[model samples]
Target: MPVAVGPYGQAQPGCFDRVKMGFMMGFAVGMAAGAMFGTFSCLRIGMRGRELMGGVGKTMMQSGGTFGTFMSIGMGIRC
Candidate 1:
């Protein structure tokens, strides 16, 4: 018979890790996209989506406290 885990005592992180990770990823992507939109509107008036997405890449570099809050909420639900 197959066991749920191998020789290691610890099991792989499952639902909660996935939930928190997904939420954090989405939030970060959204924040960057929002910044990209603002850039497209203000500085790059004639520029389009591809150019705007470059700004998004740059914008996502910073880690603000926003994702932390969402992660905490997910953890709270898990507990």
Candidate 2:
């Protein structure tokens, strides 16, 4: 019997792997966008010093988590 192999002659990635990859990609993109928007908004609102850092960090995490969750779900569905 013949065995199935991926393009590189390796086993194909499983569903979980695909989902994980999707999440990481989404998280990176979301974090970058969040940082940019958060910085601008915080500065506009007169946030300074630690306050600005905290606000930007919070926004980044929230956006990253939201995007990761959705991307993982979408990847899982495709598998």
Candidate 3:
């Protein structure tokens, strides 16, 4: 009687490893694309977007400062 050979095992990463690698690569690509687009938009559109964004950013900063001051004062009252 002839002896039968079993299936050979492959030396490679499993399906999950491939999926994880793909996700990491995709995330890096997305970040690079976002950065490129942001730069392009900033340069091509002149100061319009920058002005609008700056105004909003200033408002947010002022609001945050006011909130922090109020929180500190409230804490001081208790201590």
Candidate 4:
């Protein structure tokens, strides 16, 4: 649930909230980076057909998860 704002203004997000936000942002960036790199690598390796798609998909997920976890940890530390 969303937190309510007081008369003064909106309250700052908690540590967990910040971490979550960071993870989401990092995941998106990581996915895009992974997709580009994976495609290039696969093509250079002469991978075609389903192999290319599978390799790209795997790389994207792996990189996204790795980045998200690191980003979340970094954000949490600032709290």
Which candidate has the highest TM-score of all? 2
Clashes of 3: 0
> Between the candidate structures 1 and 3, which one is better when assessed by lDDT?
1
Off by over 4 Å in 1: 1-3, 6-10, 42-79
Q: How does model 1 fare in lDDT?
A: 0.59
lDDT of candidate 3 at residue 66, scale 0 to 100: 49
lDDT of 2 by residue, 1-79 (tens): 4545888889877878999999999999889989999999999999999999999999999989898889989999999
Model 3 regions lying over 4 Å from their true place = 1-10, 43-79
**Local distance difference test, per candidate?**
0.59, 0.92, 0.51, 0.91
Ranked by TM-score, the better of candidates 3 and 4 is 4
Model 3 / residue 6 / CA error / Å: 17
lDDT-wise, the better of 1 and 4 is 4
Candidate 2 TM-score to native: 0.91
lDDT for 63 in candidate 2 is: 89
Q: Where does the lowest 10-residue lDDT sum fall in candidate 2? A: 1-10
Question: What would the TM-score be for candidate 1 when compared with the true structure?
Answer: 0.39
Report how far off residue 23 is in candidate 2 (Å). Answer: 0.8
Tell me the number of clashing residue pairs for each predicted model: 0, 0, 0, 0
Clashing residue pairs found in predicted model 3: none
RMSD value for candidate 1:
7.3
Kindly list the per-residue Cα lDDT of model 1 for residues 1-79, writing each as its tens digit.
3435746777656666767775776577656656765575535566557876665555544322355456657665775
Candidate 3 structure quality by residue, lDDT tens digits, 1-79: 4433456754555444555555455545544554455455555667466675664455445444444455445444543
